[model samples]
Target: MCRLTFFVVVLIPIIFGFCPPGNYEYQTNCYFFQNNPTGFSTAELNCVSIGGHLASIHDGFTNSLLTQQSLSFFNASTDFWIGLDNLQTMGNNWYWTDGGTFDFFDWSNGMPENLQTQNCVAISMIDGRWSNENCFLSKPYVCAINSAATTPPPSAYPCSGGFLYYEPTNSCYGVYTHQEDQTWSNSESYCESLKGHLTSVHNYAEFRLIAAFASYGKYAPWCGLFSNDGGRTWQWSDKSSADYLPWQPGYPSGSGPCVALAHSGLINADCNQEQPMICKIQL
Candidate 1:
């Protein structure tokens, strides 16, 4: 009786669909379950159209909640699409479509087979266990909607040549693309020549300043963030904290050991792709 009461109390809002009509409120985000069968890519696109991504679970509670909701929502006895996939071309690993951490999962035994053809993930409607499925298969999906970020102001401080000062992190940033487009290696070398390394982002406010560099208008430039084994871990070229990762929906899903900043967010790109770069020096 005690456990049931606690569970029911915790589920009040989620069970009542307290969000805008047809949406379920859970924590700070809203989830919308779509019963229509759709392919994984199509399902993700549908979610993104509403300023969110296909639901990405971070903990067991969320997993259980989705499972219970599936029983209440989806009529099919099969599976539903979630935002987990091993689409990164560089390695056979799974990542969240909303760019959340890849820490928790409840994969069924022998599941996530990692077959190249079965890269997308779906949750069982009956047990909520995860399984890697062919991306083309149609499945019901849930969308997790949330808020957005605000742009940051720009300023410069006297530290290094061609660097701008971002007060929050007490660091200087430089956008280098003048002489020629450079690969990630070349960009880091250029930054080293300026007594710094490729930029390392600490948070979203700093990221916004880097993305909307004045006049450049939403520049896509190489940053220090890189994952050696694809989507598992990230490190800065400057060896700074790499905590703030703002990725475009379903991003970090390509062949990547390199990262770049864009209006959408951090993206995985081929290291050899010549582009402008951002450099940072801790101050």
Candidate 2:
């Protein structure tokens, strides 16, 4: 008689808890593309319900990546809604839903039409270029979340009062309420006293986090952007060069010495003007 031996093997699959099912990861974000057609407003609400906002495209690499993903995941001739719209203000001035700069635009010829009727923006699957369309039009859409980096265990950090830890940049942000309004310089000093500085927005994620908190007040909050050398050069409070300036169209005429951030856009204001402020400290 002969004896035989057998062995068994078990395999485990890796799971990324930061992103939901059917979502792809890129850099520090997770993106989800929906194939079901819906109006832009409903799509935006759907994204928010899922803990993200409509996708905001920032650069060429991101654009190409999203274009390829859409081509692969969605059907041909499917136009997708992005987080860009000009409904907040007049003219063709568009802004990302996260309050980011409209830096990269791949518009089809004679596109964006500069018409108020077409306020929402979408990417054409046929050519990967962008075009303005009526917000009510039904279309598929994309959503983006900041990923695990933006959501850490709260017990790990020692943020106080209104200050909250933003895990993406490892920074803490706070909005203080004073007995009296303060000027931009005074606000900066107050933040410095707290071992931080006026919040400086480096990208859409950071800007969105700050904007959501700053939206409560009627007045715009002073950020870290300002001009020195008699308005010849502009820079952040940390002396960083202005790499991503999203000033409203025809703004920053080198007039005012300070900058304030509103839901509409960045505006230059007198340094002495009194307003609320946003502060940030790196951890």
TM-score of each: 0.47, 0.53
Error (Å) of candidate 2 at residue 142 is 12
lDDT string for model 1 (172-198, tens) is 666655445778998888778777888
How good is model 2 by TM-score? 0.53
lDDT tens digits, residues 201-272, model 2?
877556655655555456888889998776676789966557776675567765478998765457888999
- lDDT score for candidate 1 against the true structure: 0.69
Superposition error at 108 for model 1 (Å): 0.1
lDDT of 2 at 12: 14
In model 2, which regions exceed 4 Å deviation? 1-51, 54-158, 177-179
* RMSD list, candidates in order: 14.9, 14.9
Model 1: clashing residue pairs?
Answer: none
